[model samples]
Target: MDIFSNHKRLFLLVILLFGTLTVFVAIFPALNNQYSYEPLPDSIPLTEIEQRGKMVYIGNGCVACHTQQVRNVEIDKVWGSRPNVAADYAGIERTNFWVNTATLMGTERTGPDLTNIGKRQPSEDWHLTHLYQPRAVVENSVMAPYPWLFELKDSIKITEKDKIVNLPARYIKDKSKKVVATEDAIALVAYLKSLQQVKLPDGTPSPEFLYKREQKKHGANESGGSSALDGAELYTNYCASCHQTDGKGVSGAFPPLDGSAIVQGIDPTSMVNIIMYGYNAREEYGEMPAIGQINDLSLEELVALMNHERTSWSNDAPEVSLEEINKILEELKKQNENQ
Candidate 1:
């Protein structure tokens, strides 16, 4: 009590109390987070180039718009296979003595979440074009173009190994010139491509998305059993980025799904096979990854997707049944086994 009257003693006591509170409130929790959580067993740490790209991502203010987080709510399920967990960011480390690169879980969802973008859109060409001019791939995009990340070259030299970006004629200012990605752009794309979510260990049940919206079987067709999943919504989330909403994919990059004979053909063997096994059209277009397989799409979801593609745009084709897709999947599985 007498010490309270002395300013020096009172000041010392206040400092001690502040220090104690800081230790408990800030330092301890941070230390616990750093030590307690571990990366998922299947999750790979960022490579050297990817680390540089992470720095580029921070430097370009990408965190200001795009989020790396996927909330547990149903609405956020489209962004990722599952919600963000502590293990997801466990491998992240500080950049240096000053910068904390441990978490880049951005604040706003101004742009789509990048949690599973690698699996969703794996095309290097698409990412490069998008980086050069967002509007080239995404019409009506508000994200500013990183033109500085690209260099315009007159022609590809036979000796130099330069990866030319595939840009639409409309976006090209000089018809004679070609655009190539800078090292920064390539690194950034590498970082984006590495953002895939790893699968949980075998036999381990994945966390369910909460508060799922109940909707009628709107993706239903007379030929096919009604799907609980909305085909249009699924297409928008998974396919629309490369194959435009119009079903006409980006020229010289993504082939148009509209008016495709394979899409409208009675035999959905090729369509289903392409979805399940992926396609390589790198000669003229980007390689299509095995999206259905990667996402572990359900039979009902596959039916919905096939039906959506078959019927959307100028395409007018018979919707494939769940049984049909299941049969194809079985056949494919047998072939894989034989191989």
Candidate 2:
């Protein structure tokens, strides 16, 4: 009763209890050296340019649209080879002892998770193009373009340091104007390229779980083979990341293959050329990469892909043989020589 009434004693007791808790629960754990029994990993750190790019990423509020974290769940499978862990972010160092600004693990996912985007899409051209005009690459992408991060070339002599963008003729209708990437754009891309999942620190629990699963997947693919895979399945694996499943395209970014005259055209020469050499600005679309040559797709695979595209939806184009496709390609080469 006396203690309850004593204000000084109560204050002392509260201070003593809280102080002890602060030391034991917080300070002691931080000081306990055994906690670091696992050695510091040899994971690569981001370059100085990459760090600047990170600032650009932060400045542009990229985190608002994209998430850095990949949660441990079934739906997050497309994000990374494995579920994310603390080690994935261990490379981020503190700004000072008191401040840590690098904790970019976002709260929402307006866009896709960026947990392993650096590895999944390593094309600098694709990223820069996407940044310049999201819809150009992604069709109906809702992302706002960061056009300010680029400069329009107006018949100026291009220098060695100048980073020119390969846009479609339609996009740069004024022949005098050519788009060049700026430093901020380069830095931001460098930063996005740096947002990769690091190898798990040695001795972490189930460290190899995800990697083993990936190896097994590859092994199965190697045995079953790309040939055994149907065109639809192949599209799902490769093209779906860009062209999408429905083939309606990204709206303004990817051109719709479902109803494309190119796919269903009587002459398959242009289609074969597109597959081999890719294409540039037809209208609003930016550039279609030569994915066929890059992936070393077989003639059989090309035939299947074209067949699938031509026959899908309401399209009813007659199939052309491989021999016909080769002959057409050869004829096109001859025409080019005459020109």
lDDT of 2 at 183: 97
Q: Who wins the lDDT comparison?
A: 1
Q: Give the TM-score of candidate 1.
A: 0.88
Q: TM-scores across all candidates?
A: 0.88, 0.60
lDDT of 2: 0.70
Model 2 misplacement above 4 A:
1-42, 96-99, 168-175, 198-339
Please, what are the lDDT tens digits per residue for candidate 2 over residues 1-339?
687799999899999999999999989975563354332375577798888898788889998989988777656766765677655565577656985666688999889888777755545667887888776666678989899999887756678797776554556656887788999999988888666665565665543233233221211122122343366655664466556677776554457777788889998888888876678756555566676765566776676677667777777888666666667767866876798
Give the TM-score (vs. native) of candidate 2.
Answer: 0.60
Q: What is the total number of backbone clashes in candidate 2?
A: 3
Give the per-residue lDDT of model 1 (tens digit) for 1-339: 898799999999999999999999999998998889888899988899998998899999999999999899999988888888888888887778998885788889889999999988877878998998899889999999999998888874422678788877788899888788888988999999999998777896888889998766664567765447778887987788889999999886688899999899988988988988889856677678788887788888888888889989889898888888889899988998999
* Per-residue lDDT of 59 in model 2: 85
Clashes of each: 0, 3
How does each model score on lDDT?
0.86, 0.70
